[model samples]
Target: MTRSSIRTSLLALCAAAVCTVASAKLPAPSPEAAAKAAEAAAKAAWAGKVDNYKLCLSQDKVAAHYRKTTPSANPAAAGGAACADPGPFAYTPPAAKPAEAAGAHSPPGTASSPPSTQVPAAAAAPASKS
Candidate 1:
């Protein structure tokens, strides 16, 4: 087992492991799990917005401090867009409709209406001579 051969063997093993991992299929998440994941994603997005807002505020503060301390040739040109603040984090999960309310099935006790009596257009049309 020379050094080069051992390194080659290790590389091959690593490649095989990577390929195996890449091809693996994870089981689908349950409904509850999916809902949680969605909520987590929303929270993460809100967190990102909050982070950006904080960064913007810090940058603005820094810029203001720099302007106050340093004399610039043009003082009037210091105007820039105001920093936007992401006020708060609010995650409202989408309202779930009950099976009946979602129109999954006809209302509880009511009988289904009879089939339509009108003939379909295709069948009613006159046949072509050709």
Candidate 2:
């Protein structure tokens, strides 16, 4: 190689070594920074999922509408109007009894009292037997 080329190569090697040493001396990312990065990644992923869901639901609605307006329209051509599931996390219970419903609406730290009833003494049973 020419003298100039050799000189340039050596300079390049020295620059790379300097950069490596400088980077190695740098501190690692803080916990807060790492958490923010993770959160950003999650949000991006969630946004993508939401976009897909919206597109799917819209397609179904269009298909259903077309099928409704034109009964004779081809089934393959008309996408069904069924919406994508929101999720299985929601729930509904059977109608609560009056007593149970009332308790559910009460504030916490306020426990209801048990039913009051009278009971005979233990000796009462033996007295009755005799």
Candidate 3:
């Protein structure tokens, strides 16, 4: 093969290898890891909100300054929506239900009954004729 063809083949092979590695399934996160991930995600979301709030406040201040300095033919509207302040970062982890409360093993009211109440198949059958 020509040098260009060889390079193209190698590049295609490398691309395929990268795609295979990227598509490979990742192992499920442990419960603790999952909880930490959830908390991190919550924190990131709150941080984004805080950033947006700060941006809004800064924009309002700039607008007010501009209005004071510049004379306009027509005054801007008197009222607009106020900038919301995201007070604090607080994340409350969801409560975990106890195993008993989860009711995974059996439905409600069945726990009082015995383990097995049905008679054996052979015993329940009538005796065969001679």
Worst 10 residues of 3 by lDDT: 70-79
- Which portions of model 1 miss their true places by more than 4 Å? 1-18, 97-130
**Top model number, TM-score:** 3
**Global Cα RMSD, each model:** 6.8, 20.0, 7.7
Put down candidate 3 lDDT per residue, 1-130, tens digits, no spaces. 9999999999999999999999999999998999999999999999998999999888878877777777882345536788788879899999988887899766777467688769887787868989
TM-score of 2: 0.37
Q: lDDT tens string, model 2, 1-130?
A: 9999999999999999999988886677896786667667766766766777889978777777888889788878653455455442322333436865677767656657654436556644555544
Query: Considering TM-score, where higher is better, how would the candidates rank from best to worst?
Result: 3, 1, 2
* Poorest stretch of ten by lDDT in candidate 2: 87-96
- After TM-score superposition, the amount by which residue 14's alpha carbon in candidate 2 deviates from its true location, in angstroms, is 21
**What is model 1's C-alpha RMSD?**
6.8
For each candidate, what TM-score against the reference? 0.59, 0.37, 0.69
Clash totals for all candidate models = 0, 1, 0
Alpha-carbon runs more than 4 Å astray in model 3: 73-76, 100-130
